[model samples]
Target: MHGYTTDKDDYLKRLRRIEGQVRGIARMVDEDVYCIDVLTQIAAVTKALQAVSIGLVEDHLGHCVVDAARRDPDEGQAKVKEAADAIARLVRS
Candidate 1:
């Protein structure tokens, strides 16, 4: 049904792994782990989240935006704008 349809499970698995990583970071804090070590884990989690965001953005452009464009040029343009706005927000974050 969509670009990510086949890989939905994979996304979920990755997200779950990231969740575990977050929990681990919490544990590290609880144990008073070294600041650098905690920062390393934090960086890893940030990158993992960025990866997921990029994947979703790709799926949006490849599937939802394309489908909308096919249905109507104006609608497609709107989708493109929306996607751009989303990317901008993500970049700002």
Candidate 2:
């Protein structure tokens, strides 16, 4: 666990937006919407999630990983490797 932090309000806003998108998707499903439209919304939600994940990863690297690297080279390297793995997974998805 890293001592990572972010603006609470911004995080909440993003979550709320994502929630709305999810609800919209549910509504589309209930209405038996077109296949393309449903798929587009699903893609939007996936992209949003990825965006959030990337932002957190960037923040962790900037703060936690940088701090750790300054204190211990090995720890910093480990953090970098972990972040790289996460990014690779994200890219694959």
Candidate 3:
């Protein structure tokens, strides 16, 4: 099982909340809400998503990478590389 299996439900719930926030932002745009207000909501959603990403990264490192390393050094290295690439992408974004 994945490292995050235990916390999957929590992640899904957080994602759903972020999704709702996005819809709300869209609605604000449609309603001609103040630009700063819309921007603030967007910022909030961005931070929420970043928090989720960080959690997933932690889970991946703690579970997947550790397990792979125990099972095979080569596999562990690959997982590390993969995770590093993912983190790089997150950083660039």
Which is the leading candidate under lDDT? Answer: 3
User: Which of the two, 2 or 3, has more TM-score?
Assistant: 3
For this target, which candidate reaches the highest TM-score against the unseen true structure? 3
TM-score of each: 0.94, 0.88, 0.97
Please write out the lDDT profile of model 3 over residues 14-84, one tens digit for every residue: 99999999999999999999999999999999999999999999999999999999999999999999999
Error of 1 at 74 (Å): 0.5
lDDT measured at residue 27 in model 2 versus the true structure, 0 to 100: 96
In order, how many clashes per candidate? 0, 0, 0
- Choose 1 or 3, whichever is better by lDDT: 3
How accurate locally is residue 36 in candidate 1, as Cα lDDT from 0 to 100?
100
lDDT of each: 0.95, 0.86, 0.97
Clashing pairs in 3: none
What's the lDDT of the predicted structure labeled candidate 1? 0.95
Give the poorly placed runs of model 3, Cα more than 4 Å off: none
**Candidate 3, residue 7: how far the Cα is off, in Å:** 0.1
Better model by TM-score: candidate 1 vs candidate 3: 3
How do the residues 1-93 of candidate 2 rate in per-residue lDDT, one tens digit apiece? 443355556767887999999999999999999999999999999999888887788788888889889999999999899888988998998
Q: How far is candidate 3 from the true structure (C-alpha RMSD, Å)?
A: 0.6
